[model samples]
Target: MAAPIYKVAIVGRANVGKSTLFNRLISEKKAIISDIAGTTRDRNYAVCHWRDLEFYLIDTGGMGEKSKDIINQQVSTQAIQAMAEADLILFVVDVRVGATTEDRILAKSVNRHKTPKILVINKVDNNRWRQNNDDFYRLGLENQALVSAANGVGTGDLLDQVVTALKKIKKKKSKKNGEENIRTIKVSVVGRPNVGKSSLINTILGEPRLIVSDQPHTTRDSQEIIITHNKNKIILVDTAGIRRCSKKSGDDFEKMAVEQSLENVWRSDITILVTDVSEPLTWQDKHIIDEVIQQHNGLIILANKWDLVKNKDTKEYTNYYREFFGFARWAPIVFTSTVKKLKIGELLDLLVLIYQEKHRVITDNALSKLLADTIRRHKPTKGAGTKHPYIYNLKQTRTNPPEFMIKINFKAILHESYLKFIENNMRYKFGFIGVPIKIRVAKSQNLQDK
Candidate 1:
């Protein structure tokens, strides 16, 4: 049985090192850490285990009451939402700067929730700042701890206290949940800026768990959200929109955001490429597709904003994408509109199916037959004076984006077209929909053994 996941949110004003403390607690650099104010714009969640306790540690954006910027307001709203859901809140503050109005505002917001909280006085690495930490108690939370998240001082004691609090919360609930050992399917939603990637996720979740805006790159960090459907736990990762690679670019945060977004593709089991249906596909969209295919991730192409198109011909759009993205033609495409709530359920069903296909395994007997039929249908043409590759046997070596190994005659070369033919035949014989298959060729030591 899995222990119920209790949310412990780390909230503070801008540049208080909440993200740094979050990384220290989880022991993983899952959240982007920067000195820039409000580097974190969304709530980032990661599983944290301390001693005998396990819970989700949520890192939220800095809250400020004075910022009138729309994005800043959205950031504060996201932090408030995190506080509302958290079972325990860590109200982080910088001891050096003491408690300011921003900290007071965030503290008031955190207190609004009946949730239990601990005031974390951060950056007290030396005695000078440590002695003056009494001002933080003015926020009115009784429980408090002092630590420097940058150098990892006093963090272990802080976590010990956290574990104690979490234990109480766990005992009070006393809920025995099942499916602790169930594997989580990771699906990364990626696309160009303002293409509705986060909106698509919000639609599927049936709530605004993520911040949505007309502005590009609203989602800076790749946020992981866990949802259960039909007994399957799926982690949908909402990634930052990737811009065209150029020497001239956005700030360091945006650059890091793009790098992390691409990195999610490599880490996820499936990658859902969301494109704006109202506009023509650009090189950036194809660039993301290539990355997904290269990573061998189960793929689903989503055509977003279907309501805006005059010609709602799904087939036409599919054909156009297939022609342009010929390399990734195996990917399944779904048309979605967050505003109209189109195909939201269908997308979920397809996601589950694609995840299953990624792990589909074929027996060697079936693979041998597939190889024989492929060769008989379209044999490799013999090159002038050079022997063509003679493939004798084929077998699946791995699953989850299935990989096959082919044994060919030594001192012979196989054309790329022949490999394509084998891949095509494999797909036709066995359904490997929405999954990329890897075919590796190995030269046989003996040529005439067969």
Candidate 2:
């Protein structure tokens, strides 16, 4: 029997080291760390295992202050949503700053949930700071833990407390058989700033789970959300918009946010590249596409804001993307509008299909037959000083973004264009749609076989 996945949320006001604590617990730097307040505008999710217990740890944006700004309101909403969904809450606070008005306000919100919460007094690097905890205790939480998230002081005890609190809660068992064998597909929604990446995800989810703002960089961390589509489990990652701007123009927070966004492309099994259909594809968009191809994950081009575009010719936009993103010709394109909710259902269906395609494996006998037929149609060209290079064998070495190995007489003599030609034929015979195909060439001595 499989155990239920518990959820633990870390909540607090801005700059209280909540993200630092989150990183310390997850044992990875998934969240972008910054001294700037509001650096984390979205709720970041990651799995954490402690004392043989596995549960999800959610890092949420700062709440309180009750600002009238649209972004602040949305950030608060996201945090509240995390609190509502979490089974446990870690109310992190700064020891140096003590408890402020915002802390008191957030305390009330965290208290209303009836969920178990622990008041974590962070930044207690030394005994002097650790001795003073009266102000924090005033917040009225029965449980508290003092730890230095930066120096790894007392974090073990904090985790122990977390385990103890979680043990008290009961978990329900799932009745589905073979649930353990079902693989979760991680799909990352990535694109340039203000291009409706968050909006697109929100439209698909049927709720505003992320903070959608007109301002760029509203999403600084890669927020993960799990959803089931056609009985397939998928982890949707909403990443921050990437920009190719200089350091002087961008801050450290933005730089790290971009780095985290790109890292999601590598971590996910599939990537949905959101583009602004209203404007022509920019160099930055092309750069992002290149990154996805380099990672060799399944790719889906989502041309967003289709309602704003003057020309609605699907064929025109399809050909335009093919011309600009020629490097990723295998990737499928879906023109969608968040406002009109066009093609939202189709996008999810396509995602499941792409996941299946990425994991599809072709048999060696079929591959060998394809190679023989392909070579008959067009023989491999000769090198500068050599006769026609004879092909020996073709075999797929791996799947999940299928990789193939070619046994040739002289690997160096084989041109990349020919390798691409072989890949095209392979795709023609077998469908590897929405996923990148890798071909590896190796020298073989079986020239007489061909």
Candidate 3:
């Protein structure tokens, strides 16, 4: 049996290099690093291994003076939650800015958690800056490490301290049999600004892991969290809200964020595209759908904010969306209200179902039978030439965006409509309800000879 991964949270005030420190510790650019304060509104998580010890590293939004704004309050709440769950806390402070009243107040809050903490004085790039590190000692934390996260200086000493601290804490044994083999599905929740994507993820997690606000673009970085539900491991990714490229061109930060959001869809196994029920489907939504389909990624459409809709007839809305988004007919649609917590559990169930279907494979014999029956029912029309395209063999080449290869007669050009017909037949015969399938054609050796 393996031991549980100890959790270490990097927490501090906004713009104090928390995200930079997180990226440094994980040795990856998983979190977005920006000079703007409050750039990271959600708690981003990753696993870090130091000196043979594996631990979970969490990067939380800055915590400081409380504000009445819902987003600020939510961010503070999430930081506190991370502090409570962590076995140790990395209290980060900026050396150049020095410690302020907010740092003192935040220090007091960290002390209340009763968790062991190490003060990390960041941005101390050279010996001159190292002298100023003593100024942060006024915060009253005993242990301290100096480092410049941006340039990766003095991080080794910081990690050594972390490892030494972890050695004292006892860890529980993990079940060895089949536990390490559990498959984790990466589900990326994406949509336009203010579409309740973060709210929906918080509802499923049953915690305010992300900051929710009425303002658009509240979340700027892609946050990844792992949760176990019904013995299934799921990696839920909450990405930055995507805005139109034209609207984002003026701001380089926003442009980068939008690009990162699109990249998340490409990297994920499945994408949950959230849309507002009150608003009509727009060109941006269609553009995102096209990207998902073009990437050959599995997709699920979620009509969020359903409670705001006055119409109780969901069937009518469903029919309208079906017609409006006919291009994504393979994607299943679900109505949800993140505020009301309606069908949130059902959403997770559907996520698991679709993930399973995405990796489903069809037997060669079954695929052959299905192809024969489909051709007999509706024969394909002739293409540019006089001879019609005759499929000689069909076999599934791979799964996860299931790809199939078909050997056909030479010079038999299959029309786009004919390919769609074949795909429809494949979907109807095999239950690939919420996944995209790719079909390829090749000329048979015998047909090539002719």
**CA-lDDT, candidates in order:** 0.87, 0.87, 0.86
Candidate 2 global TM-score: 0.92
Question: Which candidate gets the maximum lDDT versus the true structure?
Answer: 2
Roughly what TM-score does model 3 have, to 2 decimal places?
0.94
lDDT of 2 by residue, 1-450 (tens): 353468899999999998999999989988888887887888888888889788889998878787889998888888888888898999999999888988888788788889999999999999999778899777889899999999899999998998999989987745666767776899999999999988888888899888888888888888888888877788889988998978577588778888888888999999999999999899998999889989988999999899998878999889999999998989999998999999988999999999999989899899989988988998887555565677888889998879999877754377777899999998888889899999987886665645
The model with the greater lDDT, 1 or 2, is 2
lDDT tens digits, residue span 176-237, model 3? 66767777788888889999998988898887777878888888888887787777788888
TM-score of each: 0.93, 0.92, 0.94
lDDT value, residue 302 of candidate 1: 92
Worst 10 residues of 1 by lDDT: 170-179
Measured over all alpha carbons after superposition, the RMSD of each candidate to the real structure, in angstroms, is: 2.2, 2.3, 2.2
Residue-level lDDT for 273 in candidate 2: 93
TM-score of 1: 0.93
Q: Return the lDDT, model 2, position 242.
A: 91
In candidate 2, stretches whose alpha carbon ends up further than 4 angstroms from where it belongs are 1-4, 174-176, 410-412
* Model 3 spans > 4 angstroms off: 1-4, 247-249, 447-450
- Of models 1 and 2, which has the larger TM-score? 1
> Residue 165, candidate 1: how far off, in angstroms?
2.4
